[model samples]
Target: MSDDCIFCKIIAGQIPAKIEYQDDDILVFHDITPQAPLHLLIIPKKHITNLNEIRTENADIISKIFTQIPKLAFQFEISEKGYRVVNNCGKDGGQTVFHLHFHMLGGRHLEWPPG
Candidate 1:
């Protein structure tokens, strides 16, 4: 894990986060600055820099994240209401943290062409 990465620090117990779920390969937590009523982040334990760095070998880890999204949405009381999962890529994509993560947002109407 990169020492400078915040998500890595969170995963290592070096930084505090409102964790929602955790397993051997992944961790889910609440967003510090929430955009929606239920804004959460799903992250992998491995220190991947971004989505471009994901490899075929990481399929299982990625798949597990997808499989848990619905459950997490339900837990956050947003499943029946619907939700959106997002991944910001690079600087232009508005990614502040380099570590790969997915943002789960719900509990409000999402408009088209998100900024």
Candidate 2:
């Protein structure tokens, strides 16, 4: 893990977060700054930077994150209506944090063409 990465700290238990789920590979937590009623971040335990850095070999790991998304949304009672899964790839993509994370947003109407 990167020594200065915030999400790394959270995963290592060096920092505190409202964690919702965790396993050998990923950690799920409520976003400190929630955009939707059920806004959460599903991050990898290893520091991956962003989607642009993902390698083909990481397909299974990426699938694990996607598979867990609905399970997590179901726990929050937002799975039936639908939810949005977002992964910002770079600075221009609105990625504030360098860590690779999937934003799970739901529990209300989400606007199309997110700004």
Candidate 3:
């Protein structure tokens, strides 16, 4: 884990967050700045920088994260309504943090071609 990674800090329990769920592989927490009514971040325990950095060996780990999103949304009461899972890749992709993570947004109608 990178020493400067915020998600790493959150997973390590160094930086506090409104934790929603956690397991051996990932940590789910409420976004400090909510976009939708249910704006949560699904973070991998193993740091992978960003989408551009994802390697073939990381496929299983990434798949596991995708598999957990549905359950996590349901757990947070956003399943029946629906949700959007997003990952900003790089600077052009609007990725502020370098860590690989997915945003689960729901509880409202997300506009087409979100920014």
State the C-alpha lDDT per candidate: 0.92, 0.91, 0.89
From the highest TM-score down, the ranking of the candidates is 1, 2, 3
TM-score quality measure for candidate 3:
0.94
lDDT per residue, candidate 3, 67-103, as tens digits? 9898887787888878999999998888998899999
**In terms of lDDT, which candidate is strongest?**
1
Residue 77 of model 1 has an lDDT of: 84
Can you give the lDDT of residue 76 in candidate 2?
Answer: 85
lDDT of 3: 0.89
Candidate 2 per-residue C-alpha lDDT over 17-63 given as tens digits, one digit per residue, 9 for 90 to 100: 99999999999999999999988999989899998778987756798
Candidate 3 lDDT trough over 10 residues, lowest sum: 52-61
Model 1 has how many clashing residue pairs? 0
Give stretches of model 2 more than 4 Å off.
Answer: none
Q: TM-scores of the models, in the given order?
A: 0.96, 0.95, 0.94
Residues 65-93, model 1: lDDT tens digits = 99999999778788887899999999999
Better of 1 and 2 by lDDT: 1
Q: In candidate 1, residue 105 scores what lDDT? A: 94
Per-residue lDDT of 67 in model 3: 91
